[model samples]
Target: MEETAGDHQACRERPAASHLSWAGDGPETRSGLALGHHRPGETPMSHHLRTLAVVGSACAISATLLSSAASAAPGSPGPARVDAAGDATALKRPAWTRLRAEHSKKCVEIPGWSKRQGVRADQWSCVKQANMQWALWLVQAPGAGGVRHHIYAIQNRNSGLCLTVDAKRNGSSVTQRQCRNKKYGDNYTKQLFWYTPDNRFFSQYAKGKCLDIAGASKRNRALTTVWKCSYAKNQRFKNIK
Candidate 1:
């Protein structure tokens, strides 16, 4: 049977809730230190000086606390402050790589290294070709341990277009299109994907859907498509070389 993007629509029930949009837990708002009220005998100049003195004292205290926190020995007790961007940065996939299907050993590529949009990506014999290399760029950052994993935009090295799905359901057209933002709202997540935490090689572009090879065929030029997210061999892929 010929393979197309819109092939396997309902492999399993899609989760009732999924975190498609993502963002970090940004820095907390802090209030400035308050100086005491005016004294009965205080002149304007004296009050100014007193205010400066209070500020200086507060700065010194802050400095001391900072020094202590910085110098705290290994295995210290207090909870270390967590940066909101840390989790997003940890999942960064900046390096370009050639994704090879686990079952066929062929790399995903844009046919003929075409630079046109709407070109369906396919699998070909692994090679040092420009179209085969892809980069997973973090498009949306997930909150610290938040639900919906971080989203990445997969771009073809040669065409520079992003991998986008025609629809959210399985077997929708998986083609290279101009990178679009999620805010644009016309089925925006068609281009957004995230690596499965349980399986390092599985990439899901939509809820319950993942990138897959048609019939796991070893033949060159085998079309790639989206299928229900699973542990299936055809759905698994890894970096070439």
Candidate 2:
């Protein structure tokens, strides 16, 4: 299909409810650590001093942990604590968890999956199929290869009345050839699913394409289609916890 934004028109669904518009505060107020507006007499020096204090405290804690870990043997509790730091960082971001919650809350459950054999299909009562249930995750293949080598398109198989099962897509992009089955088969509908947790923050997976913000609002009616992977930040969807 033609590449345009808003290609998700066919699947009926609400707008604001699915999308969170978080710009993460502008550059001037990016940190969001300040109290109310500053008083006229307060010197800029104070802010610098406070910032340095916070940084120093964090460094000191890190240094202490590192020093302890250095003294410990290879298989020691100290190493475990150091390792936890990495996991903790990932846990701090509730992206995927939020997405799952939203899917359960906003997505309408469609039943009738068994009839289509390997395929699945479902409709959401609250959110549009496109917004809630009709999307896929694009992941990087593990190994040394170009961007296309690691990119994959994964989506649930929809057949008959049931929606979603186990089916995945592996390729640089969408395939033009359609699969036909004498008994029952479906041509990829080319619908992308935007799994969002908190609204603005979302992780999207396309059957053969990636979501592009610049084109989203413009061509709203265009059907979903595959496009070159630009790896745009908008395409980087976060899964909400």
Candidate 3:
């Protein structure tokens, strides 16, 4: 298909619901230390001074604890902490990968995947080509209401064009189009997709569509399009390498 700027129209907006929940050790508790009582010969002034010192130390410790808690508030995108093993287990981000169709035994490919726009994405015999690999980038969709959904842009490794839904309609053929760099006013919604826990590639723009192998053919060059998502094997794919 010929490349055209008009083929890349604005994407529709959709709300997201996924959020990263923070899991860590519970709030630290400090034990109350018993202050020693004044002895029989101890002066009243000295005992009073000792008591005051203990109270001041306790107050300082309490302030420090509060400060730490505030910094580690839930949903805060702060740096990951090291565990007891001294290993820094940072938040795991999705990586670039090649998607292999479970039933067809093919990989998603963007034919003539270049810097041009309007190239259609399809499936081909599993190969080690770079154009068949995709870089999965997570982006927040519009109208998410503060929830972080698993929206992503499947960008071609060689061409840099993102996997997009042509014409932004249901049953639209999935294709490779220009990547949206801006935050808004682009067809980002059409380009965004999410992988379900069951490994189905769901389209963010299409309300209930998923990336599917047309006709469920198990042959090479079988087309990839958007269709009503189902639990069929043709609709399932997994990232490899």
lDDT scores in order: 0.63, 0.29, 0.65
Q: What residue runs in model 3 are displaced by over 4 Å at the alpha carbon?
A: 1-94, 113-115, 141-145, 168-170, 182-186
Candidate scoring better on lDDT of 1 and 3: 3
> What digit string (tens of lDDT, one per residue) describes model 3 on residues 156-228?
7677567888755545788776665434344667776778778898887787889988888887777889888
- Candidates in order, TM-scores: namely 0.56, 0.22, 0.56
How much lDDT does candidate 2 score? 0.29
Clashes (N, CA, C under 3 Å) per candidate? 5, 35, 3
Looking at model 3, residue 26 earns an lDDT score of 33
Ranking by lDDT: 3, 1, 2
Give the C-alpha miss distance for residue 19 in model 3, angstroms: 67
Where in model 2 is the C-alpha error above 4 Å? Answer: 1-141, 144-153, 160-214, 218-222, 231-234
